[model samples]
Target: MSKEIRNLEPTELWNNFADLNAVPRGSKKEEKVIQFMVDFGKKLNLKTVVDHVGNVIIKKPATKGMENRKTVVLQSHLDMVHQKNSDTNFNFDTEGIKMKIVDGWVKAKGTTLGADNGLGVAAIMSVLASNTIKHPAIEALFTIDEETGMTGAMGLQAGYLDGEILLNLDTEEDDEIDIGCAGGIDITAKNVYHEVHTPSNSVGFSISVKGLNGGHSGMDIHKGLGNANKIMNRLLYESQELLRISEINGGSLRNAIPRESFAIISVSSAKKDTFLKKINTTINEIKKELKTVDANLDISVTETSTPKKVMTTISQITLLNTIYAAHNGVYRMSNDMEDLVETSNNVARVIVKEEKITILCLTRSSVETSKFDLANTLKAAFELGGYQVDLSGSYPGWKPNVNSAILNVLTKTYEELFNSKADVVACHAGLECGILGTNYPDMDMISFGPTIQGAHSPDERANIKSAQKFWNYLLTILEKIPSKN
Candidate 1:
């Protein structure tokens, strides 16, 4: 709206993206965006259908002579992960994302840019509105709540789509075409312990870890980025001689690597000065060690004027031990594919409540058995620590099919357009393709997108040249689809 939104090539694509950004559509809150798409379809007089869970499908007839070609589905999610800097004052529920153009890249003002799938949605909308592109009969499938959960994909009924080939537009890299993705499950550890009021002689202080480069736990898990919750717990565990733990908390989303964490503890007045000195020294050591990765890391300890309430020794020990023992990074690498992470877990969040302490862990793996094995291992650890564990919303991984016809088409199209082969990969992160495959066993799928960075974090940005390349590649693919034999 301001200054005509510069550097937005492919006017239709930019128009839809800018328009969609004006709607508040975080995970599980996609009604506004979904309705907007439906309205757009109605305005164009195209056939549209909305399911109970807000998944939308807009149908477009084939061009006059191309009606006999196989139907293709253009798929992408409607929701985005809502993440912002701690100092940002914007509200995702009511405010639209503030985007800025800089050096040919589009990014948000201290928040996630939503281009992970928003760009996919815009491309689909652009195709639907185009009158010049040649293509088969098409269906644009817009799913909801993909970031938090694959709800729309899980709820998709068999025969909901008539397309045999689906081109997913949710992947991040422009040069890589993803044919498969890892599956994921949410593992939770909950424990309830009694609390007791401590004598009011000690000083209360809060220790915090902030400014770490948190990213998509799945995509960035193998990068050795620091987990704030893990680092904070390590600090507390090493300082127990001088400090008494009161409360601990960190991480906000299950899929995001924790960037900041805080813990409240009490220290004896006699050892307060010594405690601060050692803590600061340790913080400096950590900063030095992680300087190459988390260059902006900040660790601080400050005295608080609040009274302290203590938890039972049993609860305190259980919580601290669990945090210390739980695995929070890469677990294994793929034996078949070099450098591919086979299994990993993120100890995403920790919360200390009135009567319980809860730890949320997310496990992912390209192999289904490995995923379950890791989940069981984490659950066993929680049980050993005297806690109740629960696993929820487990989804299957999409196995790579070397013989997929869609992959062949995309590969050929890319080679013809760019005069080079496009990289085909099986990603370590989850994609909606897996769930869609489960519902429609015969559906052929492939995922490709422009370059996007820091997807689940505040520093998210989309590359301009990659967007142009993606558009060119996609248009070529659509034009080259052959008639089904």
Candidate 2:
């Protein structure tokens, strides 16, 4: 089924991507992938080292005449976010990603294509293994767990390489050169709730919110797509007077905007009519609001077996109000860069079962102060509702250097190759350039890649044509690297 993927243009790059997706490289669970990379480097007769935190670094000598160019650090993450349609039957832990070519794009079957960083990783691997591509001494640094904590980048120490310039091939656009990106922190709120016996003559309904277009929370938050957690909360909040939740589960990852939610809720038989009316009303309003952005948005409710227990009234109300108070969309836009989202929040996951409830969120911003301002706002809201809020995995944002020599070289090279200027900009998505900069502050860094759409979600795909363009552009920039001063 995946043979077509290897047959794509730029056979070296696509072949590498196919081999990568064959391994189970989910975030933070990268032992096999790390070993896979190490073996590949050894097979090529290059010097390979696995760091204390599982990052793989491989060094290759410059090819022939390009020896005078400065040593370069080519980096991309080893792990990909694991997200699949609720109806898709696939296990990310043991099986390779199943991919198909669709109308100039390559996508996974009912799951994330892993092209976000996979394409970048493949590109770096292609460059490393090539004998004909002219380039300076190459240092391929593949860090792990970028999709979740970015701990791999955090744990990398200085002196790991002698590279003067870092080329990060993780950007999602073909025509954009990324100079800066947003920092992010994880917010987790947990609370224990008491469950009560099901009331006599109670009824149950399975509430489902699915078919929403979940994309990268940071990149697609501004598009006004419906968040399943928020939408599910709305239905529960509206029916709180008559409803009791037995079990609620929604969303998978904290970075992928939630696309589906499911809940087994109970209500007294007396209030069944009112409960249905309330949910139907909210469903209509949500459909109206998301019509432009989520035309396929689906919300439904149906009769189900009555569970033996449900959340206590007090706890039920608290969860509802807490989610309602929590912000789930763009908090602020960048005044420094046009069309740039400066700060945002994604109420990515919600769970309520037995005697426990947890809410997980990711807040991002290019500005440090503003990022916390929004995080604190959420902390206050969750705390007031009796949650123990904990913040973690904080990472810095990449600071743009518009005048760096490497940036100038890439800009001039791209214009010469494509006969047009690249869109140099900052992004809200978290990139490893910022965290890696902490250990190597003097290293010149830049990020650029092929066009990828619907990242961090099952709809993720890579543009076939844009990938070729990116490969051509990257090779030219490598050959034009100026000799060290």
Candidate 3:
């Protein structure tokens, strides 16, 4: 807790967030947050229910004279993405998020801020606790495991919610209303190779790529930020003449762009200085090439402990080729929407474990056929390189229904409250609405939120002014819902 973190509106949001953060709620591990919401509902004496998948639904009766209005569901995910800086030593399983305020923005000290949906969660809590705001029948639906997958929403029963109109408070931009989102799939390639004990005359060294700005692969795909894994592959390909590879590893989450990566290699003791000089020269050249985008990018090498065994020559070549051939960055932009990315792939994580190497890739596309095509392409590449591929955790995309009654009402409300038209569009990121819509076919939905930057990454932050505007807009929309009967 720093001195600068006190007295901000996001501080109030963080206080509640800290309570939620203290409990481990990573993807499938959402029982604790579910209980917290259940207990909060009990304290308020509201009608509360928890599904088998730990999704919590809390209902608040309509205000006097507004009981006739249709029930509205305020939806947000209960889980936050688990990511941290390489140097920060906090464990996500037990430690609370270390948050602080800088100027007027709220951010984490060295981790993701979780404001992607935490602010929405807190705003709903604030609304539920307030006795002054006037509103129609409301249901706060907190679904679990929205980050890793949409398990909670996917498991939702048809009659689980009584609301026909759903307001998903999950989009990152404030003034933009997101009506659709891209679907995603996870692809993994595993290769097991024999290791050989090499002579002790070889020196062990580590090569690293650092200082690149990595963000949400979906939102920042077009930003031209260098992927550390890709950068490392390029370095290895360039320096293979001077070094022998041993082990390589980087990244953790599939949704976030990797900012840094490192590789362990072996070289003859006599060639150490030349290897270092060559790597430095390559780093300088890459920096110059990416000067406009990754100005701070750096590549460095250092001496390290020798490995007991190294990959065989055949295995090493296969691994290097596979990594070099892996697809990355934006694959295509939407032909229908100018400047919008329709398909993309991220080679998120690479690890060497127990004589085996695993590469995890995440692919997203607004178009269903494109997503499958990208997945097939990756699968074929891995098979050609003689590796076993596994595909799992696929989620469907949510398509926009511009003709819905809820969108009509939201558009009118925005005009009435702010005297400006809301920017309505679709996104390439995943949202829970797609799964919820599948559960309840007739449900009408729209998503909006305060401005949040760098979501799912360490640079995450929320704007205070945008939050105030979001709260005001929500209050206006609540008071204007049409009657059900």
Candidate 4:
């Protein structure tokens, strides 16, 4: 048991979270966590079922007097996004996250805290383990690969669950209840590149951008933080005439805003000093432009070993222009809802290989047509650069239900506990709710969680105070669950 986390408020919840953090559960590599959950369910003597794709469901019978209430499902993902800083030496495969308390927040050491869904999973585990709290029949669903593919939710069968109400424990804000969310699709664009011998009298230099606060591309798209890939593209485009590209690489995931990017280029030795100066000037200008959102943005140039080959000018130009022209960040705001993002694109990753240059992107929108339209726009941009484009991993948005019964119960419970109404909102980020709803069309779902910041990044943290309040609010909601007429 972790003394640091076990001492926090809502001790049961935090303790469970600590235990989960002890295992390596990165997306698509969640076998150990899945086994732990299964063993946990057995220890509690609860009815546990592991679905075809590794989604776990643990069922607990209704308390003595609440047997008449409708069955409820408390859902969260088991796998977490694995992200670490460039300077951090932590490994997600063999080690548990090192957590620390800072100013009343629980954060990891230079790595993602996994609080995006880990806290939710802990809350569910606590509830299942509790014998004191009154509640209706409960089903705790732990899905897998939510960060990378959402494969667990995708493979869930229609008749697998008996719940009429689903409480998705994945939202980040404690004061807001997410009733709907945007759908998304992943795009990969690839182009062949021919490398020729390095130009005579040229030297190789590496340019890099780092220290930007990259976050969940969908949720943080409107923050105006720098995109490392886009920044690298701008610099390359500006220096195309004087440089020959040897390699370009940025970002690793298709759903995270890039925090760092690097490119290797060959430049004439005579212009080395001028080239470095120009890049430094560009860095300063960019920093000034994004100072409000990204205070530590860093761009620097350093000499590197001369490469034997560089990209053809035509290929370099096409690649840079394609990246420069591709849309990034918020593309449109919702007309129906105030302060809602309706459509957006994230140039999530870029890679240069000996044979090909590939770019990966994710586009999201609550409206179906807008999502496809944005995908078409990206396809066109890459096609014009002679790249083949493919899109997959598409999921639908969850439309809001104003007449949701569970929503009424939750709202009433929240008001009774805190004397303030919870904000009902729609999220721009993709949620498993959107995909799960399709199989269980009649279920009423609402998403909420403790106050978490910097999700999907190394700076991710959960507020200790909010975690307790969120846990109490959830217990009250479950205890007061109303019976279906």
Candidate 5:
């Protein structure tokens, strides 16, 4: 555990967070963390069990006077998005997150802080280990693989949890409560073609797009952030007449707005000057358009050694056209809810090498039909370019119930404690509540947490003051959980 973070206010929460961050818990690869949670539960002598899907559940009887209150499930995903700066040297698999306190916020050094759900997991740990904090019967649900596909939640068994209420401490903003969230599907396109040697008089140049603020593809999609893959493709499209792709690679994760892209191409030597001028002009235009949202965006071109093989002109055209056609930002706004995104897509990843190509996208929507609508649209665009597209990992959305019992409880409690009403909103990101509710539909579910910024990116951080405030609110809310009805 980091000494500085352990010394933060709300030591109970921060200390546990420090310990949790010591374990590398990336999505899909969570065996170590799963064992860690199981060990933690057993150490506390709680009724611990691991489900078939590797989800950990530790049950604790209610505090002395609160045993009559309704049972509540304190839930949070154990896995977090792993992102690092291009210049930062860090191995996520073998190393723990290194944290520092800056301007009243806890941030990791050049890597994701894992506060997205790690803080939530820590909060649960505090509550489960506490002997004095008042609360009803508790079923702590620690799930895995939430950042990528929510596979852990999807595979959770029906009878494991006996809670009547589920409090998901995964929301990023401390001032708001979330009752609903969008569902999502992964869209992947793949193809293989023959490679050809570069033309006799071709000159090689490397084009790179970097310095953009890449963030969570779902939560930050509407902010008009730059998609590095899309920007690089734009330049390629403009210089198609003189350029042939030797290799192109962009983005890393399927759920983050890409931050950088690099492509090596060969251009006819006679048209080299014209290509440079065209690319510079396009970069200026792109800068102007994204000035407000992606202020740090940069695109550069430099000469490089020639490669023996390059994609044929036909393949290059098909690749450029397909990426150009796919949508990269917000697609529709909700008519029913104010300012809520109804449909969106993130051209998350693009890669071309050895005559093989793959383009991946994530399409999201709260409405079921609209989700498929946008997904199929992308499928058609890629298919038109001779790529086979697959849409999978579809998850359900959590529809809002304005009259929810827990919503009323949270509203009343917030106003009583802080003299203000908490904003009730639905988010564009996928939350595990929707999937967990499938088996336990009667469980009233809601999500809220401390303010976190730049999630899914290296700049991710958690606010110290907000963490303290959220901690107090959580304890108060637990003590007030309605008695068994």
Candidate 6:
């Protein structure tokens, strides 16, 4: 066990989290962790079932006389988003996370801490192992691959679970309860490009944008941070006459905002120095504009070996125009919920390979019609740019029910525990609750968790004190669950 979390309060939770960190549990590559969980269930003698889609369900009988209370499902995804700084050497497939403690928060060294859902998974494990906490009949559902595609939640069969209430331990804030979340879809645009020999009397250079605070696409879209892909395109479009593009690449996962991007281009030798000067001047101006949110942003150009092939002028224009015209970041605000984002899009990734160039984006909204409208808008933009667009992985939003029994119970419990009312809010980010609700329409669900900052990026950290508070609140809620009529 790492010394950092070895003696933390709520010993069981931190202990289990330490073990989880030792396993390689990146999205979709969860075999070892799946087996580990199964072994844990077997060791504890709990009733465990592994579904076809790799979701793990563990059933625990009520403590003593609480059997008459409703069956509550404590749910969290098993997979964590893997992100690291460009200079970090960690591998998600073969290595474990390196943990540290800084300012009372548990974080990783130069990589994502995996506290997004790993902490939730550890909480469920600790609850299952406890013999002291009083609670209703509990079904702990550990779904897989939530960060990327949500394939585990997607494949969950209807009637596969027997719970009237679901407690999603996936939100980031400690004092806010999330009752609703936005749905989202992924849009991809692809087009073939023909490469021609680089124009004579030209020199090659790499223009790169880096040091921006890329974050969770949906959660951080409104922060006004610089998007590396968008900024690079803007520069290219401004210098279109003097350069011919050879390659363009940026971002990674579809759910993360693009933090860095690089483009390889051939510039006329006679104008190379002037072009570099203009690029540097423009970069400084853009940085000034985004100084508040992206203070560390850097854009630079460096000479590189000459490339034999470059995208034809037509292909280069089409790609650059499409990127420049794409809509990214928050597009609308919620009318019903103050300060909540209603609709947004993130230009998540751009890739240029031998056969084709592709742009991957995600659009999210709480309103179904609005979601489709944004998807259609993306389609039109790509088609106008002479690329084929495909939309997939569409999921519905969870509509808040103010009169929910579980919500009332949770609110009362929070008030009694902390002497203050918890804020009932809706999240702009997509959550599995929306997808799971379709399979169990009547499942009353609420999502809340300890404070996790900078999720989906290398800066992610879980507040230590908040984890204990979250645990206290959850256990109290379990004890206070209403008995069946």
The best candidate by lDDT is 2
After superposition on all C-alphas, the RMSD of every candidate to the true structure, in Å, is 1.4, 0.9, 1.9, 1.0, 1.0, 1.1
Clashing pairs in 1: none
Global CA lDDT computed for model 5: 0.93
lDDT of 4: 0.92
Candidate 5, residues 117-136, lDDT tens digits: the string is: 99999999999999889999
The whole-model lDDT of each prediction reads: 0.87, 0.93, 0.84, 0.92, 0.93, 0.90
What candidate 1 gets wrong by more than 4 Å, as runs, is: 1-7
Error of 1 at 275 (Å): 1.1
Error of 4 at 478 (Å): 0.6
For model 3, residues 1-485, the per-residue Cα lDDT tens digits are: 53344455545544565566556677787777888899989999999999988899999988898899999999998998877777888887777777776777778878888887888888787667768778888999999888876788888888878898999999888778888998999999998988887557898888888877788888888888888888888887777767777788888788888888988888878888888888888888888888898887877888898766777777877877888888898898998877778999999998864588999889998898999999999999999899999988888889889898889988888888889999888898988898789878788999998899988788898887788788888888899888996
lDDT of 4 by residue, 97-163 (tens): 8999999999999999999899999999999999998899999999999888788999999988999
Per-residue lDDT tens digits of candidate 6, residues 194-259?
999998989999988988888898888888878888998888888888888998889988888888
List TM-score per model, in order.
0.97, 0.99, 0.95, 0.99, 0.99, 0.98
lDDT for position 294 in model 5: 86
Better of 1 and 3 by lDDT: 1
lDDT of 6 at 25: 93
Order of models, best lDDT first? 2, 5, 4, 6, 1, 3
Candidate 2 similarity to native, TM-score: 0.99
Scored against the true structure, residue 382 in model 1 reaches a CA lDDT of 89
Report model 4's TM-score to 2 decimal places: 0.99
